[model samples]
Target: MKNSTCLQPSLATTVALPVIYSFLFPAGLFGNILAAWIFSKQAPTKRTQYVYLSNLVTANLLICSTMPLLATYFARGHQWTYQSVVCRIANNFGTLIMHVSMYVTIVILCSIALSQYATLKKNSDAKHSPAANENFHRCVLNKFRQPEFAKYLCIVIWLTVFCITVAAIIRNNILANAVGEFHTCYSISIEAGKFTSMLAASLATACFFVSFMTVLLSYYCLNRHLSKIQKNTCIGEKHLIYGTVKRNILVIQIILTVCFLPYNIFSPFFYVLLPGNDCKKSNYLVEIKNFLNCLAAAKSSLDPVIYLLLDKTFKRSLYGLFTKSIPEHHKGKADIFTEETPDI
Candidate 1:
């Protein structure tokens, strides 16, 4: 018999994983589901970018829905008592959804940033000419009048994500057979090959670093532009436009830094430093690392909450959820505390 040191999860892991899974599974699933629903009700012409966001939320819900099964596996002493095929399927599905969700989020974040920048540029251009303003408004109206492009983009994104996920699963399964594990799932043994392990670590590190830098640079440029507008000598529509852009950019930056960046920095280090051998202390470290990863996954759920608070449309949807009538619908028409518009 080959000697092996399989993980024996600690009491803390046993307790913590289930608790974390409970919170994550329900919150992520319901939050994303609600986001999708609200998005469906919105004017399709409002923001085509939000269609990508809706797909992201759906992917996140799929990923988080699998957490309970993973938690169950861990609870069973990290053993594969389940059928080998079932284990592989579960693991592959969970991993595929997670990776797809993450990459989709990265793409959507970049898209949203670029879209906002473009919108700002368009607005800036409109300031110079009444003719240009009329032309732009006409274009906007025409763009919204058709829904074909948005529908095609949404379909393409879904199909692309699905194809990539399937390809990864097939490739991993083939690789698993050569690595002496027929029943393996998402986790590749780091000890299988030092070169392979190092390569994986390097790739993960590079991706995280690139994403972090991209988001940071995008926001830095946006903030500098907004600051210039704030310091501008003229006051008018540009001021209101710049203010809205600045506020939205600030909120996005804060979420990326505080909620997302910490986990990205932590994950690669955790994967590299933690050995495959299941020493008691090493297992403890792995548990802590997994908890941090859970925190990272939880950020998807948090993103929509941030949107609800920062974006007026989401807030209106939230209010619509809790109240029979949306307060915004009654704006200026009803007797209320005041006829003042709420600040975004």
Candidate 2:
């Protein structure tokens, strides 16, 4: 296939991508790296969720840190001035990081939903009898005494993503052969390769859609069950449980739908339109594709911000990092103690 005239990016996009990349990449990379460090320092406990969350943060950081490579590529007029091997490596790694990040998020979200459901179910079972309720609460609390299952799941998730990514890299030679005369790196022969591209993108979209639906359905069922319980019982604590769970689930769902859904929807369209017969007409579509690709990268930053907003432990840790001062009274007491103590 004859190469189509490359579309010139608008000044607005040229400016926006770099600015967004600069702010998002550094901040997100730093934040998620800090989060992973913090999580690592803590002794492993039954809190398997934290393990998964940390892994997700690590993946996001990896993705965000690669944005500068992309920015540099675009800044040079979409030319891949880098070596062919480096270009392929960067592209493949960036893509792998993104897929890993998405799947990690999906796993974490599902875990949260399942945890909430189990908690609610235990509460419901306990409501039937005082003795049974106490025992159930004890059992629920004790469940957190072992982190083995969660750790195993996290390992499995990462391994699965790794295998899938390796398979893709092995099967796709386009990344190796698609460099233009100007050395601009792109996927191969879009018209000829449209089927493979579309197939891969469709599978990704389907996975995302399925995970999204799982989250939505789980929340709906949970809420419905809570509502039924609320109608039957007049316990004040019940309201608190429902309110907290509802708020967290709602925020997560909203972010997933708003920040991530557009990329999923537009990506397949971009791939399909890229190699169509109407080259001039497809220019705008290709531009849109590039824009969406950038948007997907930006989600790495957005995910950490979401964690900060929604996860109380993360918020507290971030706050502690930013706020270094102790209370005035405590400081004074410490100073006095130091002065009075022997020089040991």
Candidate 3:
């Protein structure tokens, strides 16, 4: 019932996103690019965690690459037509890509948590071995634990997310076409697409919660095991190993909580919960939503800090980048990944 003028952008709304995102764009680009380069320098071993971590870097890179477009959209999206080709491209590349990165990062972090737990579980078991009844163990997410299989699964994840995102983009463009072009790209007429948008948001919210729980559960079990060891004696090698592993899991959980939680919690409100007819309420809510989304998109830059904290090889590789003094530089590639290096 309200006119489009009701939710007109405030100067804060206009300036905030572009400023925040412009800064995020360069920082994210440099961080992710640095991460990818460091990963590439690692010895060629199909370690399962490496696979997930590399894909995470790739996902983060995808998000950061779109920051400029997203920044521009926040500043000027209302002036564009959703049905235009350029608008559609921006919607997909800038907005849709952010969601894709979000979900991809979530799923992969879940994979990492579960995979690490499985590794820790098997290692703690005295009877567990390479040939110890893999048939029974295969049922326990073992398929994802294998490096070769992990590559295939990561590919499937990318494809599945792309398919879903593209479908949403197509549906929006079609609806925008039908609704007539004057609606402005930013105001996608809540009354027209409320059902579909809310349904999608509900599904995505459910998925996010599932990933959140998975990370929490993994952290609990891992920390519990480590707690037992540390209580006995914190000086041992086992205590140190499990401690680092638990810290890594904790960092992942923190990233999910800080970066994505607010967005997921508030996003579903834009359709069904919020009264779009109320101008003041709608305007403030829209700004909040955009700011929350900016936070979600910020994980791309934060992941490199996690890598530094959790990955010894990556840390050493980063050190390698600056220093020419490689330890045993003459040692062949085969000797690089020695038995002395515990693959934790």
Per-residue CA lDDT of model 3 for 11-105, tens digit only, reads 76568888888999888889889988877777355678778878999999999888888778778776776556655666667767877777888
Q: Estimate, for each residue in 24-103, the C-alpha lDDT of model 1 and write its tens digit.
A: 78887787778778777852434555554666677677768778875664455355522365575556665566656655
lDDT of 1: 0.56
At residue 227, candidate 2 shows an lDDT of 72
Instruction: Return the TM-score for each candidate structure.
Output: 0.74, 0.77, 0.86
How many residue pairs clash in model 1? 0
Question: What TM-score does model 3 achieve against the real structure?
Answer: 0.86
* Superposed Cα deviation of residue 65, candidate 3 (Å): 1.4
lDDT digits (tens) for residues 20-115 of candidate 2: 777877877877777776566631434655655666677687778677766654454445432466565555665666666666666665555555
Report the candidate with higher lDDT, 2 versus 3: 3
Candidates sorted by lDDT, descending order? 3, 2, 1
**Residue pairs in steric clash, candidate 1?**
none
Clashing pairs in 3: none
- The whole-model lDDT of each prediction reads 0.56, 0.59, 0.70
Tell me, by TM-score, which candidate is best: 3
